[model samples]
Every structure is written in structure tokens, then in C-alpha cells.
Target: MRYTITGGAGFIGSHLAKALVSKGHSVDVIDNLSTGSMSNLDDIKNKISFHKTDILDADSLEGIIQNTDGIFHHAALTSVPESFTRQQEYENVNVNGTENIFKIAKKLHVKVVFASSSSVYGDTKTIPTKESHKLDPINPYGITKLNAEQLATKYLQFFDVVGLRYYNVYGDTMPGAGVISKFYYCIQNNMPLEIDGDGKQLRDFVYIDDVVNATISSMEKNTGSCFINVGSGVATSILELANLFLKYSGSASKIIFKQQDKGNVMTSQADILFAKQLLGWKPQTTLEDWIKNLYKS
Candidate 1:
């Protein structure tokens, strides 16, 4: 099947594209290059079609999705803090851009898999969050993701749609998308890993390979407007992560403490039972193992 991945040059999108291409599927990428780099796709540059386009540009996106079988909507302004300051830009790119995808997909009858966020649950006492958990977003980035997810659900009345609420995803070659990425970069550069709020804040950090596998399996089996948490169902504290990164990289660096970030959740753990049931997928890598592997040749 022919696939078009938005933000295909980005971290997760690049991994997904390579996975699909390895399986002998035709792949096309439409990335605005806002955060994505062409070097990410260098390994498979000759295998897939690349288009420099934004999701907000309906005319350009329309042409690309014309003959496409499915789309993985991954493009958006992803930073939580930046979203607070650039509310209008996030709304336009993340929300309106998603709406545009739905519009075009509706016309062409194409299936869509939306990349949503776990932040939509906001500051929760709930240990492991379900897909039906409250949709109260603490930040504008989360709000935009929730909006996009809602659009996918609405469009499901006409076409096939799947929404995956991703937790803190980390992997090799990924940029400073989250704390883990920062940890990797800092460890390599001999910089301190800064922790906010005592570093006890828990997060369900899922490996990228597992996320890509779950995404594909869910997209294939989803028959309705199905949504599920794409996470490891395991929570790790920020302090634990810092120790692990230091251990793996064999680096001796102090962890600095800072004021807690506003609009940030204290804890997040995903109830991935739905993913297991729906996609028959489970995360294979543990935090320690992934970190160890990351530093290996």
C-alpha cells in the first residue's frame, strides 16, 4: 500500500518510514522541516518520495494524498512551553492543520492515524491513564493534540481513523524532544542533566521501536474511531532516568535541580491494555536496556 507520512522527516516519522520501507511498502513523506531534518531520511532517501510541504497548505497536501492509501498525521509544534507562548501558531499548525487533513481524507476516503499526546489528561492523580480519562489539558500543546484527536473521532463517522496518545517517547538519534533526549545529549557533551521538582516526577517512557510497531498494528486492526495509549505501561522517575543515563554513558556529571516547570504533570502512566487487546502489541524494551543499547556501537 502507498503511505504518506506527515512530518516524515522527523524522529518518529523517520523511524516509521524506514520500518514501512523495509517491509517493501511504498512510502512518501511530506515534512515542513520545522523540526525535522533531511539527514534523518538519508538512509532511505532513494526508497521513498519526499515533499517539502506543510499540512496547512491544503493545495500542496491535496496533491500528495491524491493517490495515497493512508496517512500518518505526525506534523505539529510539539513543545509544551512554546505552545503556551505561540498559542496562535500551535492552533493553526496543530489544530487547523489536522482539520485540513480530515477534509482531504474525507474527500479521498483515505484512512488516517493521528499522533495525539498524553498531556491531554493534564495533571492527574490517576496512576495509569485510560483512553477514556479526562481530556483536561494543562497546556496549549496538549489542547491542540486533544483537538486533533477529536477531529479524528468526528471524521471516523465517515472514514477509518485511529488515534494513539503517545507518552514520553525516546530513542537513538532523536533530538531534544523530551527529558530523555536531553539526558542523552547532555551525557554525550558532559553537561549536567537538570531536574525540576525533585526529579521524582514519573513518566511512562516508551521506546520508539515499540511505538512504531504499536502504531502499525493498531492502524491495521482499527475498524472504528479507536484510540489507545502507546506506552510501556511502566512508569520511571526522572531521578531514576538520570542515574540510568549516567550509568550507561559512563559519565560523571552532577544533576542540577531547578524550579518545577509550570503546566507540567507530576506523573503519567499509560493503561495500555487497550493497545494489547486491539493491536496485540506490548512494549519489548525496558528503560535500563534501551539506555544501555543506546550507548552501544
Candidate 2:
């Protein structure tokens, strides 16, 4: 089998690309290196074709992605605060770039499993947010993701599309990594861990391996057109996460609280029952286990 992974030099996309190669599938990696790094693909660089092209370049994308069986679309600008400052750029990359992928997929008659986000359900009242939950994104980044999902739906009639609404995904080598990586970095540098607000904000942190597995499964299985939440289905508070880092790293780094950024979602938790039913997937790694393993290694 042949597969194309956009943003394949980035965190989740790189992991997904390596997984495909390990499974004996021919993989083509497309990354502009804007946010993705070549070092992420160093281990398996020789085994796959690397295309240094932006997704917005339809001619280049179509040329490279022509013969692929499917596409794993992970290219996007994902920073919330950054999105607010550069709304048009965020829309251009996150939304317009996605439309380009869908257009190419439609032309090629290939299946597409794209990355969506839990940010779409920004600060929802629902404790365990489901795929059916209302989408009221609080930031430009989230709004672009939601718009991409809408594009997927629009293109679904022409080809198979699966949008995975990823929660806070963390693992080794994450690009623009979120809270987990920040805590780990602080611990490593013996710097104080800064917590935004009261440090009580809740989040569902899914490990990268689980997310990659679910992404591959969504493409391999005949799940049809649908959006599924990919997450550990567990909510961990920021304070607890900080304490975990302190406990595991054996660092005496003080955790200091600061004003939370505007447009930040107070809580996010994914109801992954739909993923389990559709993709036969469940998160196998827990935050505690991952942090503990990090120290062990």
C-alpha cells in the first residue's frame, strides 16, 4: 500500500509516517519545514520520499500525491494565541490549505483522514465532549479547524473523509508541544513551572502513539464519512500534571501561577466511545505511565 502524509515531518504526522513505513507500506512525506523539522524523520528518512512543498501549492501537491492510496492530512498552524495575532495566516494555512487537500483528494478519488481538534468544542458544558457536542470554538485556530471539518463534510459526497478531533496530544518530539512538554522542559532546566491561572484548568491529554494508531485505523477501516474524537477520555488538571512532573523528574521546581491567556478554554475532555465503536481504538497510554516511563528511559 502507498500513503501520503502531509506535515509528515512534524510531531503526529512524523510518527504516523514512521508507523506506516514500519508496517511495510510505501510512504511519501510532504512537509514545508515551517513548523516541522527534518530531524523528526531522520530515523526513517531513507525509506520514504520527502517532498518539501507546501499544501497550498496544488500543482506540487497533486503531482506528489497522485498515485497515493490515501492521505493523512496533518498540516496546519495550531497555536491559539498565534492564531489571534495572525488571523489571516491561520485561515490561509489551516482552512485554505485543508481545502486544497480535499480538492486534490476529490480529483484523485482517494480516501482522506484529516486532523481536527478538540478546540472546536471550546469550553463546552459537556464534561465528556462527544462528536455530537456543539462546536463553539473560542479562538481563530479552533475556528479554522471547525471550518476544515465543514469542508470535509462538503467533500464527503465525492470521496471518503474521516476527521479526527484530537485532544491534547503529547509525546516525545512534539512540535509546538503544549503543557506536558513545557513542564518537562522546566524540570530539565531546573526552572520554575509556570501555571496559567489557578492551575485548575482541565484537559484531555492523549498520547501520540494512540493518536497515530487511531489515525491509521481510520484510514484502513471502512468507517465511511464521519468525525470521531481521538483522546484518552480522561481529564487531568494542570496542577496535577505539574505535580506529576515534579514527582517523576525529582525536581524541586516551584510551580508559579500567572494570568491565563484570553481565548483559552478552561476545560476539554473527549468522549471517545465513537472512536472505540468505529475504529476499534482505545487509548492505551495514560499520562501517569508516560511521565513515569520518560524518567525510566
Candidate 3:
């Protein structure tokens, strides 16, 4: 099978591209290098068709995605606070870029597995939120992801679509974009571990491999068009994560409490039981072990 992965040089996208290649599939990658890096694809550079193009450009999408067997749309502006200040850019990339792929995919008649987000769950009081949970995003980033998901629904009449609401994903080569990556960097540098608010807020940190697996599962023929949560189904507080980093890295740096940032979710957990039943997928890595491996001396 031949595959086209948007943002294939990104953290998750690069991993997905490699996974597909390992399975003996041909891959074509389209990425603008906005937040993505080509170095991420170093291991499989020879195995993929790489294009340094923006997802919002329909002409580029038309050229690259044509004749592709499947599409894994991982392109987006993922920053929560960044979206607040750059709402227009977020809309163009996350919403419009998604639309571009769907339009092209419709013409080509291909399956699409796009990356939705768990942030769409917002500050709702629900813990272990299901796919059917009420979505009330308080931030622009979440809103844009939600918009993309909604746009996906409209494109379903043309072709098969699956949207996976990814939880906090962290792993090797992950940039300093998420909490785990930031903490990992600070721990390695012997810098103070910054904690927002009381650090009591909980998050579901799913491993990148697991996320890629769940994403691949959604693209399977057995699973039709639908939205699902890809998460570990376990909650870990911010403080707990920081402490684990300190323990793993042997960092004696004291933790500093900082004012909590805006557009942040206080707690987030996902109900992944349906993902197992539908996609035959489950998170394979445990939090502590993955962390320890990442920080192992």
C-alpha cells in the first residue's frame, strides 16, 4: 500500500511514517517545516517521498496525495496558548488545511485518519470522558481541532474518515512542545522544574508508539467513519510527573511553583475501552517505565 502522511516530519507524523514504512508500504510525506523538522525523518529519509510544502496549499496537496492509498493527516498548530494569540493562523492550518485534504481525498477516493485532540474536551467536569462527552473547548486551539473534526464529518459522504482524539502523547524525539518534553528538557539541563498552580491537575500521557498504533487501527477497513479517543485511560498529576523526572534524571533541582497558564485544562482523562473494542488497540507503555527509559543514565 502507498500512504501520504501530512506533517510526516513532525513528532507523531515522523513516527507514523516510519511505522508504515516498516510494514512494507510506500510513503509520501508533505510538511512545511513550520513546527516540524526534517531531522525527525532521518532514519527513513530514503524510504519516503518528502515534500516541503504547507498543508493549506491545495495545489501542493493535489500534487502529492494523488494516487495515494491512504492519508494520515497529522498537520496542525498544536499549541494551546499559541492559538489564542494566533487564532487566524490556527484556523488556516488546522481547519483549512484539514479541508484541503478532505477535498483532495474525496476526488481520489481514499481513506483518511486525521489527528483530532483531547483538548476539545476542554475544562468540562467529566473525568474519563467518552467520545460522546460534551465538547466545550475554552481555547482557540481546541476550538480549531474541534472545527477540523466537524469538517471531517462533512467529508465522510465522499470517503471513509476517522478522527482520533489524542491524549497527551510523549516519546523519543518529541520536541519541547508538551509538558513531558519540557520537563524532560529541564531535568536534563539541571534546571528548576516549574510547576503550574498546585500541580494537582491530572493528565493522561499516552506513549507515542501507542498513539501511532491506535491511529493506524482507525484507518483500517474494520473501523468505519467515526471519532474516538486515543489515550492511556490513566491519570497522573503534574507534580507526580515532575517528581518522576527528578528521580529518573537524578536532578537535585528544586521545583518552582508558577502561575498557571491560561487555556490550560485542569484535568483530562480518556475512556479508551471503546478504542480497544473498535480498533483493537490499547496503550502498551506504562508512564513510569517510559519515563525511566527516557531518563536512564
lDDT of each: 0.89, 0.93, 0.90
Give the TM-scores of the predictions, in the order they appear: 0.96, 0.98, 0.98
Better candidate number, 1 or 2, judged by lDDT: 2
Error of 1 at 60 (Å): 1.2
Clashes of each: 0, 0, 0
Q: Rank the candidates by TM-score, best first.
A: 2, 3, 1
lDDT of 3: 0.90
Error of 1 at 22 (Å): 0.6
Worst 10 residues of 2 by lDDT: 172-181
* Residue-wise C-alpha lDDT for candidate 1, range 158-214, written one tens digit per residue: 788888899988886677758888887788888999999899999999999999998
Error of 2 at 96 (Å): 1.0
| lDDT per residue (tens digit) for residues 224-288 in model 2 | 99999999999999999999989988889999999999989988889999999988999999999
lDDT of 3 by residue, 1-297 (tens): 999999899999999999999999999999999889989999999989999999888996797778888999998889998898999999999999999999998999999999999988898688889999998998999999999999998989989999989988888888786888888778778789899999999999999999988987787656778999999999999999999988887889889999999999998999998998998888889999987887565
Query: Judged by TM-score relative to the true structure, which candidate is superior, 2 or 3?
Result: 2
The regions of model 3 sitting more than 4 angstroms off are: none
Error of 1 at 117 (Å): 0.7
lDDT of 1 at 94: 93
